[model samples]
Target chain A: MTALTLHAPILLVALPLLGAFATPLVGKLGKGARNTLIGLIVLAVAGLAAMLAIDVFGSGGIPTVYELGGGTFTFPLSGGQVPVRILFEVDGMSAFMGLITALIALTGAFFSFSYWKERSGGNLYFSLFLMLIAGVFGMVLTGDMFNFFVFLEITSIAAASMVGFRVWLKQSQEAGFKVMAMYTLSGLFVLLAIGLLYGQYGHLNIAVLARSIQGSLTDMVALGLLLTGLAMKAGAVPMHMWAPDAYGESPAPMSAVLVVNSQASLYGLFRILFTLFGASISTGTVGWILIVLALLTIFVGVTMALIQSDLKRLVAFGAVSQIGYMLLGVGVGMAVIATRPEYGLVAMQGGIFHMINDAACVGLLFFASGVVIRAAGTRDLNQMGGLGHRMKWTSIFFAIGAVALAGVPPFNGFASKFLIYEAAFKLNPFLAVLAVLSSIMLLAVFVKAFQAAFLGPRSNTSAHVSDPSLGMMLPMAALVLVVIVFGLFPGFFVDHIVTPAAKALWLGRDAYINAVLGG
Target chain B: MNIGNLPFIVAALLVVLGLYTFLFKRNLIKLVIGITLIETGVNLFLVTLGYRTGGISPIYTFAPEAQQMVLPTPQALTLTSIVIGLATTALLLSFAVFVHRHYGTLDVRKVKELKG
Candidate 1:
């Protein structure tokens, strides 16, 4: 293997962390220098993610296990059977998640170039942004439970700080506090679950724990805590109260990154359910619970979004509803894991595929919203109008994002949602019907937002509004390109990356354990 | 109840009490305190996981020849948890300060600017 492939996993996480700490110092140089530094850091992280993804997917989904404090692939410590050192086990699923994070981080960094131009504390802002990226990479890459908790905290602190970055705004402060409180509580729930598992298993390694778990009372309790905590973090309904506040209050670019962060949490939840406790637990029951949560999340998120006056908050609700589709698609897979139904894998592929689709479409929407807010100087939809007159590119991009997010045909969202609808219909026609109904509602919601924001006669407030600079427009354009490409060739992506990722969760449990434990 | 289970019971009680405070408390500072209480409870639970009836320190140097030693990993984990808890508490308190400054009250009900 090339040296890049050999150390890609750790470098993917470490470079951003090192760059985060170095950002303020780099900023001391000048704006040009600071931007250069951040750009290089993000580019390097993205390159590493690509290398890692290629390696994992190219190897027929064989996971690359990197052992810290030891050589690569070291297993069964010298004196003990359990691996004591930290390990980064990057399978197809992890590589896929890493790719999503890298894409979003790169675009966010690009968008922030102009977004934070006039804002003060640009240095600290980028620093926290990079830190959040690092935390997410670590969360997705690590193989140890304790290490996951640490990265979880890292993401929590950085994300909460970023959400509250606009200290001048009282609403930002309120949102930050509420988000921090919820994040910490959920984090503690994860930590407590880890503690319970450790108390019984005497090992923090997920593979080791997975091998030995027997679904005891304590294991069940740990499972409960983990499910609740991760579900809350993933913005599932009833536990997703903090999402709109955090997403709406944060700077626009950070909103996109925040979406990826929640997906990382969702990644964690899937990892736990599929890999760690797959054989030990009654997955069907848990799957039903998730399905219920998914249905509620879908219905409530769209309904709540419909009434929002604020543009970002409305998109935030849309983002929350999107999470339900992912849960529903994967929850169906989990429900039929034992039966190994042919459609189950298709359902999983749809869910896993939707993650990237959502990232692109929602991210494009947020980026476009950022431009609109900056140009119009307000987030209220009621105050925004006729933006399309001056900002043609942004209007087109916003329309694309809205249509794609609503799962219209010939777009990335429809490609994945189609799979979900097909698979879910076979499982239960009611689920498919509800999902379709929600998609229609989502279309109406975004149409209202689009018409109110961009389609009418030029309001006095938007008289000065115009398309953003190249730095901002490029990211949205890139996302738009992704939406089109992925839409046109969903089968290509699903066949190559998405299927392997879905299979990694569906049938790669033994392979994951063996990769780490060397059975 | 067995004497051996007392620490676990106390830890659970502390966690329950902290949850009660977190759910019922109105003041922002009190909410921070509630989170801290929960962290302390979790930390205590982590430490107790390694406890033995009559164990020595986990250190190897100058250790007694025959006596048992408590597991050191849990202690290490607890210390790390404590440090992380400290960082989160500081951040939460800073946000609380900001909230108080802007809203002029720590009562959560009064901090309603972010509601749906």
Candidate 2:
């Protein structure tokens, strides 16, 4: 209702933008002071974003659109009117994503305080970190497709550069190259698709395109292109080759960001499917494609993780598998849209709920792996042994994360996976059965990681491993607490954030068209 | 002969050609060139979308001349897309330089430290 709340979306990017530049300038004044300031800035932005998300949820299903300069009006032309302005629209979906992105970014930035010190170019790290956060904010908040492409590039370049933080290492550089190539190629696909859409409709605004499109061959082509490109970003199988190596090579803090980044891509896919192409496209075909892809992603990702000797690579593969679960939920939702319209809501709820939990669980796993790498100075499970007694906090955190990822009871991961199974089973028990099989593989893989890294005899040849600094430990601890809290009280988050997001996604097409083109 | 259908087919062929060159090329610089060519095809298609039979540029210096304007939105979007393409091309080229310095070769096949 107020001006401050109206500009909430832009503030998500600007706060970080200002901080990225401020960190180095402030660092010039002192060493410790700069980190403290950066941490404070991250916490501030995250807190503000949380507040805005709450406001949006309380406002019911009405989406808030804020024009870049101010004052929104319709431009009359002949017999029609169109909106010509840069706008930020915060609906249930965008706010939910904003909350997830800001929360994870806050934790990562705070964790980096002690984790990145004594390394040269800390300022550079913070700058790139903020830019990455800003890019995500832009991606979720912007309504324009071309602008979305730009933000995707920003996220890609910053992430790829960060993946090779250890620029001197040959493995790191190679991993960086693979990730960069894949991300750029994906972006190019998205750009081409957007161009195709633009040529057909003469509108790049997503909301407008949604209304004007009505089940044409061009629409189908655009849909295919969009799905392929977004699938690559989400690390879907046949296009997910870069995920494991990139996650393995990046620093822990950045790896956490990458997990969340891929989740954002999934969210983008959901937005396109439900919000952009919902009316024009049939759910049956889209749902089948997603279900098959999700199945392959889970089966392949976990089987590959099982054979991995490197701890970071193992965690990376785990991330790929977790993405499958989220897709399963979304795919189930898509399948039920026409056949069982009454159960559509439940399927969507399951999918969106899984999205939030998977971000937390997979993010925690990557962070813990970073801690393991930091302590042992290697990610090889064979080189690691009983550091459980020495690094008690790290071990416990890793165990919590591992259990959550395996979808055990009394974890946030289980709550969502249970919902997904119920919904997916109702639609097709076979999908539900495959999901269970995938879950078992994930459990076995993590148990192996624990046994190899924490339960074996302590290797004297390995360096003396200790827990990360308190600054780093604090974020992991916070994540552990969230997993426990959300696991215990899943309904609160589900009812408030995920439920409304599902509604907006499933039935808000007309509202979207009205906001963009003004009939 | 409808003029609208012509540009679309041409653009599609150019994109296919660009992809072929990119996939087959061994040199990093040549790969980048392939990407640029593909972008050019996309951009040209975008500009052509705004075209009308007798429409002029969207810019109207005189108030009375506004009725003859072509659709300006696609043109604006294309300009933005082109600029983005330029930035990507620049970044990829610099990355190629980094690759050259590290591996002592511009061939992507020679870079194997990341392969399974």
- Tell me what fraction of the real C-alpha contacts between chains A and B each candidate also makes: 0.74, 0.26
lDDT of 1 at A292: 93
Q: Tell me the tens digit of each residue's lDDT in model 2 across A193-252.
A: 787787777677778777677778877888888898888888998678889888888887
Q: Model 2 misses residue A182 by how many Å?
A: 2.0
lDDT of 1 by residue, A20-48 (tens): 99999999998889999999999999999
Q: Chain A in model 1: its TM-score?
A: 0.98
Q: What is the lDDT of residue A303 in candidate 2?
A: 91
Report the first chain's TM-score for all candidates.
0.98, 0.96
lDDT of each: 0.92, 0.80
> What TM-score fits each model?
0.98, 0.94
For model 2, the docking class works out as acceptable
State candidate 2's TM-score: 0.94
Docking class of 1: high
**Candidate 2 stretches greater than 4 Å from native:** A21-27, A74-80, A461-463, A515-519, B1-10, B53-55, B62-67
Q: How many clashes show up per model?
A: 0, 0
